[model samples]
Target chain A: MRSKKEKKEIFLFLPRKKPFTDWSKLLKNDFKLKHFYKSKDLLSALLFSPPQAILYYFNRNRTVFENLLQLKHNFNLVSLAIILVLEEEDLEKLSDDRILSLIDDIILTSSTPLELKIRLSLCLHRLTRISDNNPLTGLPGNVSIELAIKKALESEVPLAIGYVDLDNFKAYNDIYGFSAGDEVIKNLARILQTTILEKTTNAFLGHIGGDDFVFIVPLSMAEEISKEVIQKFNALLPAFLNEEDLKRGYFIAKDRQGVLREIPLLSVSIALVPITKGKFKHPGEVAARAAQVKSVVKKIPGSNYFIDRRA
Target chain B: MADPSEKRKEVKKKIRKLEGLPALPPIIQKLNALIEDERSSLTQIADLIEKDQVITTKVLRLANSAFYGFPRKVSTVQQAMMLLGINVLKILIMTSSIFEIISKEDVGLWEHSVGVAACAKILAEMKEVSDPQEIATAGLLHDLGKVVQMIAFKEDYEEVKRKVEDGLSPLQAELEVFGIDHAEMGAFLMMQWNLPERLIEMVNSHHDLSRSKKYRKESALLHLADLLVHARGYGETTYVGLPPFDPKALTILKVDPSEIKEIYLKLEPRLYELKFFTEELKREMT
Candidate 1:
């Protein structure tokens, strides 16, 4: 697994050219580039250490082109972005079809090194910022959250999956419109984000869509994060509700059966499922146990978080 | 010799008269309009996609798929736009509509489409194609005409299947019965949908790679991808035995003969993921 912050470099496979031209100097400043003259050198280097990007110069030789195409699967496997540079007339050979179908981008060899730097940086920036964040709260969505939990389980780490849900969200949404209800969800997300940031830097926050937010953190730091999130969420509940509802401490709303009943003020419940080694093989298992714990915790009063300490 | 133009006109007329021949979804037309508009923002295009629940869901699903290897989960249409960009999203929307229609007739064909999509993606990556997504989309909908044939001319399609069961290839059967192959019929539909000329050419010449004048390389990519999927025994079709590899296409792709085993080895593992994905798609669409 590649760490998030590491020294990343690009590998350039170009024909032999004079060293230290004006254009090459521009790229040398921002990127740590390693130049390879032969296909064998590049392929061998990739086997030992994969580069973030590959800059290939197209020569009219069919053998060289085929050899380069052979490495595309390997490049994709290691998440490498391939940039091809070819002459204008040489580009005409591929003009009859979808010319650059295999690689990430193509540039005219006539372009300046500054243009290359800008284009390459933009592509690299995009590669780094691939986030599947929930639209409402901007927290990571289920996929990222699930992937994190699975990685932790695979590593035999002491992680906790905290399943957070609002106890009377539907009742509140009924009294207030969906937009206002959305605001409350966003507020809760903010509370979770801030609590995790303030308490633990390594924690992962995700929105499991609609009134359900999940956070995965180290087991030791899980209790503190969950408690702080619940505390902050409860403290902000009054501002979320109207003055009339805040004064009454409850609101009259219809249950699923349409029967009128007084529902208590909105409170959040957190069910922390500790991910122990050998206990579970997948994230779905953690989700199942978290649901069981949530059923028990949601029944209790006020904002609270409890860890499921069961086999 | 017969006039090729006269034959093409007749084929176009025959395709237009086919019963239950569906047009491209209205959303695609709207998205295309937005794409061409220079003033349109990504937010505006995403907003239009958000109006359609199915497309939105599919977009998010593809963004998070293994093909993109997007590091984070893509939840919203806006995020999917950033990950896939407009070109890929357009192709995805078009194919999803086609898949929805064909899935009703034959679940096996849908699996085949998914399998072809995965294979084409790998092949395109191998060739260093600039737009793998477009080629993958073409692979997914390569058999659009066959589905239409089954829907419009049920009896004729039944005969085609019967012949296929008897060991005649599906293409040969279509030619025997209808005087036109599915590749031709598929190209006709692509033309009707106002699809990209490159895509139309690929579909038009997938079976006859030599005939592809402009999109020879792309057509070859799809041809090889289709053959690879057939060899893998995906999609419970009556057609048996792999289609002979097109020498012209092989030459155009510059693929080494020795690389066939390697291609199969890489494509084999991804087939499982594609099957799982197709099942999930069927569940969601229904």
Candidate 2:
């Protein structure tokens, strides 16, 4: 793009758009970068072409570039300009000149590796997150919870495992249809992500398919958070039901038999044991013991109950 | 004397076999080679591409996408050539070819590749650096190692996935899981392909700019470019999150945090535009 190399000219012009597809067009055409605009023609001469020269281009708007700059990799906008060299002869003499120095300044300010690095991390992060993420309830699925527990056990930590089953959930589901039932389950899940995680707690929360949920708490805070969970459930139960349902002597819902049945209000049945304890050794054992308690709670009239491993 | 050494040797062998993930996918290696050669004729380029029938069709499909946004469907390689020009065409070909290779990845490494590539191109130009095409390539390929891990060690990858979600940098999770990283794999792949040393250096040193002593500036640039995209929060995998800034990288570029934000907003629309093409490229390539 530079002719005769006489005036040692230099021309520079900023492209108005992103991708600078316009600028890309010029470079691909063998035109000197110096020819962007008429006045900018000296760009070729300004830099020591085939000539050695360093260049720089920093993003004009700071926040966007800075946000991108936060990535874990080394992303310097300036060095990317250096990568654009023509890679030819005339290397040394052109090396250190002030007028030519401006070219490096220009290149780096516009685009660089840092920007590219930032862009890739965003895309990769997206690819890594699970799409099946339960939005209504942040609790992980059966598999994720299993892995978390397995890992905790592998690390030999002091852990508390609990299986939480809602009392009268089937009757409720049959009465309200699945949506209202979902709202109840969602309310319960919220309590877990929020109320149950205490400072001393290392929690693993999961939705085991339907009405059953699982929790893994640190040995120290497991009882406190567990008690808090039951209290919270009792406190919040009234809000989910209508005035008529609340005032009614019993919850009016269809039984699994499809006949209308009056049932006690909602409650939770929990089975908890410390991971470090010998009695409830494997996760399956804890789950089975918890299930036994949950099943027993169904036989009684109260809302929810706990399986005291000590008992 | 009965070989305490043999047992050690056996252990060492077992570990080595399990270590160093598969190199970058084969299809990527072939295409990158084809594009890097300036001496290669269009026929050579087209022939090598056509040798893989699936790749050729995908290239044609992507060539027609808005990334190129030609008026008519481009059925032939030459037509694609005429539409996208040599550089853009090469980039499209490389990108499409890459998608084809990464198509099987569940980790969304390929999707992330396209997003980062688009973001990289935008940031490069915004700063007026010449990273548009080349930088985009690096952005897309930076995590090829993860792809290798996804295929080779699914179980470990899943475990590492949770660690990352719970907050571990990709590099850290990698070390935790496989005791290796994409950088080493990338560096090895780049070398195997005999790519320009500069690209290999940039890829290997992207995570740590200080490691790139000879190519310090370029290494630092790639590092910064990678971080910028992470901060944008564009794609899914939120784990292997942003690395801290190197003060030297700032002094060299004469840039500040304020400048990064300006470019991020400016880059958003352009990224969206590229997505139109990238998706088309993926669909066709796959």
Candidate 3:
């Protein structure tokens, strides 16, 4: 039912809700779209629209930012965006100095006042929610993995820690600029998410900031997730590296000091450590142990290593 | 064909005239003259200040003001001298002579003047220039015109104050008030006192360095030093206007604008030292 021109241009389809909810108060006034969702098509005929109120509002709330990012429109984010401006009086009222002050105190509640410790514990229950994890590789960041391991340990459950490193990232970064390196990081992030998270009941995926990731999965699915990571990575990684690099038997990589060195072609090294309350006092210790085992596996050619806490 | 030094001297003399500037106490003049003499002794210096009961009292008060952090009360001018030493005595003489009870009613004027004096001395020392002492003397008197304006044109001065707050240059604000500025008056007083040509030029060109014909180097240095002090936001709120920025002044002084922040950070710790220096000078004057 879309016109040829409409089909060519990309647009984000925000949920069309009637009369907006009280939750709309969390949104900055600038983000509100003019021309309420009366019709299927977006019309730009409204007067008193700020040229870019949405940009300001988007900065305040990144979920709306994620909504903007989903827009398939080929235009740069700036050119494609427009905001619904309010009257001056309304803008001033919307700034809501008192509400901001109240919210500041509310957020501060968790971070302060030892006398309110009991209240914070009660409030703490509300902040915890289940998290989605990368499936192709389960590795997330150290912080989340530490939390996940803590949760697993609390319930005396089996928790698996996976440390994922790209086999020869430096060579790719040297050939392509840092932007391409960032893509590799993102692509690998998604790989881990898809491989390790898709099946596990409770999993966490995080980027440990640059080329490294950590994943925490229930110990029952540890071997399954580990095999999926290696299988998917082997299948997907060749496509990411260019044709010539793939042709060469050994991929060339720069070591830490930037001298070019030959590295064994595209492979992943994962260390699966089974979390035990006796040995793993904290999630951090498990992640650290996994990293240590990862370095040892990285020494071997093309592999994954799993250390049962019993061993 | 007025040299900046000559112009500055002419201005200071005029300011001195306008204010009927009270004389420096005879004891201070004697001490200053003695210090300048080929043969001057600590005992002689101490004895001269001791002759005046008021000066001795002031000297003892200064020694106690934590400027020295002396272990025991300094009961006499000699005891104060022994506690502070000769370098401190010289400073005491200079500050006391200039500061003479600048009424607290006009809170920051004296403070600003002292801050400028210390800044000029510090700057001159950094340049390894000769006679940082004379530079300090010049800076102390540089704002003599403000005093002149304060006394002569109170109403118009307020207008100038408003103009400054509204963002006019201090020179512009001064022209609105007394048809001239403190730099001009300060220079005139320096000339009347037969101060060195360097001091005179410093006063005249402290505000408008680029305009000076002679003593350009001294004027530029003075301008740079004045801006540094003004930026410090020390002293009184009565600085005639926002201090002007002269690119040429910094270039002449070989001071980078970026370096100002780091240099100020280094100088912050020395504020108490400068305060002590000022308090010391004030005591000697009394």
Q: How accurately is candidate 2 docked according to DockQ?
A: 0.01
lDDT of 2 by residue, B1-286 (tens): 2243453344234433432223233445666786787677656675444333234433443433322122122334443333233443443343331222343334345445556656656656765554345455556666655555565556766877787777777677766666556675555544443333555676787776766756565566677766776676544443455666676775655567788777678767866765564455445545
Q: Where in model 3 is the C-alpha error above 4 Å?
A: A1-29, A32-143, A253-260, A309-311, B1-286
> Which digits, one per residue and each the tens of the lDDT, describe model 1 over residues A1-311?
44434536888877666322444577767777788875545654543345778777776345545544434421223246777777888776665332354566777778888788888888777655764666665566777887888887865568888899898899998999897788777667656764565445466778889999888888899998887677656654654566588878898899999999999989999999888787898778877788899999988998899898886
Return the interface RMSD of the candidates, in order shown, one decimal each: 16.2, 23.3, 37.0
- Alpha carbon lDDT of residue B153, candidate 3? 46
Every model's DockQ: 0.01, 0.01, 0.00
Error of 3 at B70 (Å): 74
Per-residue lDDT of A24-73 in model 3, one digit per residue for the tens? 33232313333333111222111101122221221133443232332211
What TM-score between 0 and 1 does chain B of candidate 3 receive? Answer: 0.60
Q: Which ten residues in a row have the lowest lDDT in candidate 2 chain B?
A: B66-75
- Per-model chain A TM: 0.60, 0.57, 0.56
Q: Rank the candidates by lDDT, best first.
A: 1, 3, 2
Cα error of candidate 3 at position B38, Å = 99
